[model samples]
Target: MGEKQQRDRDLTRWGVSRRYSSLDMFYLFPIGEGLHTIEHKGRLFDLLIQNRGSDTTLVVFHGSLPPTQLTLPCLQGEGVSRLADVNLIALADPSLVMGDIDCAWFLGDRRIGPLRPILSPVIRYVLDSLNSKRTILFGGSGGGYAAVNFAQDFPGSIALAMNPRLNFNGTPSSKLPRYLEVCHGAMSRTPMLRVKRDFMTPNLLDDVNKQQDFDLLVVQNKNDKRYLHRQVNPFLSGVENPTRTWVSLFNGGDGHVPLPREEVAKLLKDLSNMESQTSDEYNSLGFESLGDYKQSVLSQDFS
Candidate 1:
C-alpha cells in the first residue's frame, strides 16, 4: 500500500474514518481584506494579514467548544471588523464539545502523544514567518490557559488570559457537564491522563520566568464561579514577576460567558496602538475599573 493509504489505515485504527482525511477537512480561502482561512493538520486557523502591519503580531485563541467549521475565518473577519489594523492569527481547538486541548496547550509537552509533532511545526512556521518584534497572545478560558502556556515558546511576548484554569486534571466542574464530557472523550484518546502532570500553566509559567521575558495579563470576572478564586488567583501568586503582571477584575458575568465584543475590541486597539519599550508602557494603558468596564459595555462607550 502507498504510504498515504497506510497512514489513513492507521488513523482508521484510531477511529478516524477515511472520509475525515486532513486534506478533505482543511482548506484555505480569502474571506475579506487581510483575512483568510487556513487549515493545518486537519484543524482550522484564521489569518488576518494586513498591509498596515507593525512589528507586532496579535494571536487570538478561541474559547472552548468552538464550532468545528470555518472557525478561524470567522474570527479573522470579526477581528478585522472590530479591532484596528494589525496582523492577526487565530487557532481553534480540535475537540468540538470540550475545552480540553482546545488551546494546543499540550503541544511540545509530554502529554497528547504525537499530536504535538503534527502541530508544532505549523506553529513554528507561522511564528517564524512573521518575525515579529513582539507577539501578544490572548484567549478566554481554555484559550487563555493556552496563551499562558504557549507564551513560554515565544520570548518577549505578552499573554492575556481571561479567567483561565491552570490545569485540567482535577474533578470536573459540575456546572459544565458538557465540557467535562468533551474532556473525558479527549483524554481517553490520548495518554494525557497517565503522562507526567507537571506541564500545566503554573509550572509552565515558572519555566517562562527562568527563560523568557514575557508579560502576562489576566482578566477575571469577580462573579466567575468557576475559575476566579480557583484558578486565576493561584496563577497570579505563582508567577515569578507579579510586579510586571496585571490583573483586571470585572464585577459581572459568569466565568464562561464571553467577554463583551466591544471590550475585546478596545483591548486589541489599545494593545496595537501602545508602544511597549518596557513594562511601564504596558501598565500605562488605561484599563477601566470593573464598574466602568461594565458600565461602558452597557452604555456602548467602548470608544
Candidate 2:
C-alpha cells in the first residue's frame, strides 16, 4: 500500500534478534543502535534503528524516558504508575522505538538545550544515508514535543506526533516536578514536574506552527487521561495540515498514553488509509466533540 507497509513486511522477513541494543550481539539483532553526528550543530545523538532495508529513514524522538527499548516493556511489566502513564507509553512505543524499525536509525533523546542542536549529528547521519527526498519523524509525549520542535527548527522533514508534550511553559508548580523531570531536568534545570498542571507547556495547544512547514501526522486518543484532549484542543483546533490525522482512539482511558495494540489497530488502519489520500486529516476517532475527549475508544466510537 505504502512504503511503510512494504517496509514492515520486509522487516518481518529479516526477523528480529533479541532486544539488545547492538545488532552484533549474540541475540537476534534485528535492530541496531550507535552514535552519529549531525555536522550542522557539531553534536552527536544516540541513534537506534530497526533494519527494514532501503535507506529511507524515520527519526523517532523518545519521551522523557531514556529510549523506547527501555520504556515499553517496562510499561508492560510494571505498568505505568504516574498520571501520565498512558501518554508516555502510547505516544512513545514499540513502533516509535522498535516496531518496523528498518533502515538507518535516527533516534534522539530528551536532552535539553535546543534538542536539534544536540541531535544534529544523528539527523545528519540519517539524511546522509537516505536516497529518498523525505525523512519521517514520529514521536509522542516529549518526543511529540521533539516532533513539533524539530519540525519548527528543522522544517524540511515529515513529522507524526501523538499526544505530544509541547507545553514548555505550562507545568504546574507542585513544589516539585514530575519523575520525568528528574531525567530531563539536566536540560531544563527544573526538578520533576508536579502532576497535570505542573509540567505541560502553557501554550502547547496553540503552538503547531512548527507542524506547518512539513508533512505532518498527528495521533491522539480522546480518552487519554494524562494530557487530556481538552489540554491539546487549542493546538489542534485550527490546525490546517491535510497530512495530519487525529485518531480518537481509547477515549478518556488514560489522557497520557495510548492503549495496547489490541485497541490501537483501528488507529493504525487509519494510517494505512493515508496511502491513497493526497494528504489526509482523518478525524475518524469517535469523539462527539472535543470536550468529551475521555470516553473509551472501545466503549464509544460514537462519542
Prediction 1 global C-alpha lDDT: 0.50
Stretches of candidate 1 above 4 Å error? Answer: 1-52, 66-77, 80-82, 95-121, 127-131, 169-192, 196-212, 287-303
Residue 90 displacement in candidate 1 (angstroms): 1.4
Q: Which runs in model 2 stand beyond 4 Å of their true positions?
A: 1-44, 66-113, 153-156, 170-207, 238-248, 259-277, 280-303
Candidate 2: minimum summed lDDT over ten consecutive residues — where? 81-90
Candidate 1: pairs in clash: none
Q: lDDT tens digits, residues 134-189, model 1? A: 67788777667667767766667788777776655422342223332333332443
Please give the range of 10 consecutive residues that has the lowest summed lDDT in model 1: 1-10
lDDT of 2: 0.39
Highest TM-score against the true fold, candidate: 1
Give a tens-digit lDDT track for model 2, residues 216-265: 55566666644543434435444544243333444535446555544343
Give per-model TM-scores: 0.63, 0.49
